[model samples]
Target: MSQRPTQRCHDYVQEVFAQEDEILRTVRQQTAAHGMPQISLEPNEAKLLQLLVRLCSAERVIEVGALAGYSGICIARALPERGRLITIELSSLHADVARAHFKLAGLADKVTVRQGAGMEVLPTLAADGPYDLMFIDADKGNYANYLDWAAENLRLGGAVVADNAFWGGSIFNPQTDDDQAMVAFNRKLAAHPQFDSTIIEVGDGIALGVKTK
Candidate 1:
C-alpha cells in the first residue's frame, strides 16, 4: 500500500502548491506570539479549502472557527468581489487576532469575525442563510451539532466541510468523548440522505459533504 502523506510530502506540496504569502505568514507568527494553540489548518489544507470554496461557487460562507484568520483569508480570497464570510471564534483574544489579520489581508470588508461559542452564535446567523458553504473546525465535541445546523441551513447543492475528521487517528478506537463525537459526526455526515460525503485525507483529515436534496 502507498505510504500516508509524510512531512516530506507536505513540505513538497507546500513549496509548490500551497506557499504562504506574507499576510498568511504573519497570521501564523502572531497566533503563536499571542500564545494561542497552533492548530490552524496546514497551508495545503487551506489551499484545498480555497478550491472547495471556488468549486462550490460559494459566495456566502460560514467558518465555525477563526484561528487567527489564516484559513479565513484563504477562504475569503476565493470568494467573488461581493462575497462575504462570517467566521466564529470562542476566544475574544483569538477573535481580535483574527480581525487584525483579516484587515491586514484587506478582507475586513468581506469578512465578519464573531466572538462567541459556536452554538450560541450560529443560531443568530440563520437570517443570513441558507449559506453557500459552511466550514467547521472548532470544538470536537460539537462537530455533529454543527453538521446538523449546516444540514438545515445550507442551500441546495451547498457544502459542509469539517476539519480533524480523523481526530489524529483516534476514530478507529475512540477512547474519549471528543473522539467518539468525531466518529459519530463522520458516520452521520456520510450516511445523511440529503448529503453525499467523503473524507479527504489531507492534513489530519477533511470531511466534505454536499447537500444534494
Candidate 2:
C-alpha cells in the first residue's frame, strides 16, 4: 500500500511557503517552459532555503548544482543586500539557460553560474571561503567527495544541505547503486563528529548538516 501525507503535513507546508513574488513565480514558469525535467526545488525546499538564508544572513554561499537555476534563484532572492551566490553546473548549455533565467528574475548581480564538474570546480572556488552555507544537489555518486570538500570549505556553525538523500524512498533498498551510495553517505554523515544532521523528507529527501568544531 502507498503511504499518504498527513493533513497536518500538508497544511504546514502550505502555510510555510505561501509567499511568492513575481520574479520567483516567473522563474518557476520558465523552468517548466524550458522543456527540461521538473528538476527545480519544490515550494517546501525553497522555503527551507529562505529560512536558512535568513538565519545565516549569508554574505557568501555556494551551491553544488544549478539545475535550471531553480534553487539558486530562490536562495539568491533571500540573501542580504550585498550577498552573493556561486552556483556550479555540470553542463555549459544548462549554464546558459540558467543565466537567462537569472536575468529574467533580476538576480544576475547576486548569483553566478560556474560551468564545470563540481569536484574540479569546487576546489578552485574561493579558498578563502568558510562559507556560511553549502548546498549539494549534484550527481549522487559524488556525495561523499562533495561532503568532504564542503566540510573543509564551510565555516564552523555553517550548514550543508545534501539533497535527494532518500532517493525516492529507495534508500531502504539494498540492491540499487544510488540507494547504496545514499546509505553510505548517510552513514558517513551520521558518524562524522564534524556535523550534526537530521534527515528530512521534503519532496524526496534532504539531509541538513550543521558544522561543529
Candidate 3:
C-alpha cells in the first residue's frame, strides 16, 4: 500500500469506488447527494477506519460523533456479521441526515444512533463493557474526559482513535489555552500506561491507541 495517500491514492480510491459495492456507492452518492459539511472521512482516513475495524474484527463499536454518518458507515461496514455500531450525535439534524444515509447504505439495522450529550450517554452505554473500538471526533474541550472513559471501557487489545487531535497544524505552536485542552489530552493519552500511542498528521490530526491489558 502507498505509505500516505497522495494523488495516486486519490486516483486509486476513485478506482476502488468505481467498482465499489452498491452500499458504499449509495453512501458516496448520498453524502454527495446532500450539501453537508465536508466532515466525511477522506480517502486515507476511510482506509484507516476500514483497516482498524478489520484488524479488531470489532463486534461492537462506538462513535462519539455522527456527522452525516460518513465515518460511521466506513467503520460499521467493516464489522462482522454479528457486529453492531452505536453512534452518539449531538444534533438531531445531523442524526436525521445520518439515519437516511445509513438506511441508504443498507446498514440501518446494524447501526444505532442516539441523539444527546455524549457525556451523559457515555457513562450509561460504556457500562456494558469492553467496546471493541471507539472514535472521538466531538467537541475538543471534552477530549480528555472521553479518553479517560475510553481507557476504562474499551476492551483489552481494542483501540481508540481520535480525529482532529492536531487541530489543523495548530498543536505545533505553543499550546494555546483554547487548543491546549486538546494538546493536554494528547499528552495524557500518550503517558497513560494502558495504551500504546502514536500520532500521525493525517487530515487535521489522528491519534491511535491500542489498549493494553
CA lDDT scores, all candidates in order: 0.95, 0.83, 0.82
Question: Judged by lDDT against the true structure, how good is candidate 1?
Answer: 0.95
Clashes of each: 0, 0, 0
Give the number of the best model, judged by TM-score: 1
Stretches off by above 4 angstroms in model 3 are 1-35, 174-178
- C-alpha lDDT (0 to 100) for residue 211 of candidate 2: 89
TM-score of 3: 0.86
Please identify which of the two predictions, 1 or 3, would achieve the higher TM-score against the true structure. Answer: 1
Task: Output the lDDT of residue 100, model 3.
Answer: 84
My TM-score estimates for the predictions, one after another, are 0.96, 0.90, 0.86
Candidate 1 Cα outliers beyond 4 Å, as residue runs:
1-7
What tens-digit string does per-residue lDDT give for candidate 2 at 86-192?
Answer: 99999887788889888888899999999999999888975668898988888888898888987898888888888887888788875777778888888888887
- Candidate 3 versus truth, CA RMSD in Å, comes to 3.2
lDDT of 3 by residue, 1-213 (tens): 658667776567656743356665566666666765666666567767778888988989989988788788888889988899999999888888888888887889999999987898898896687899989988888888899988999999899999987777677784677488777889998999999998865666788999996
Candidate 1, residues 115-172, lDDT tens digits: the string is 9999999999998789999999999989989999999999999999999999999999
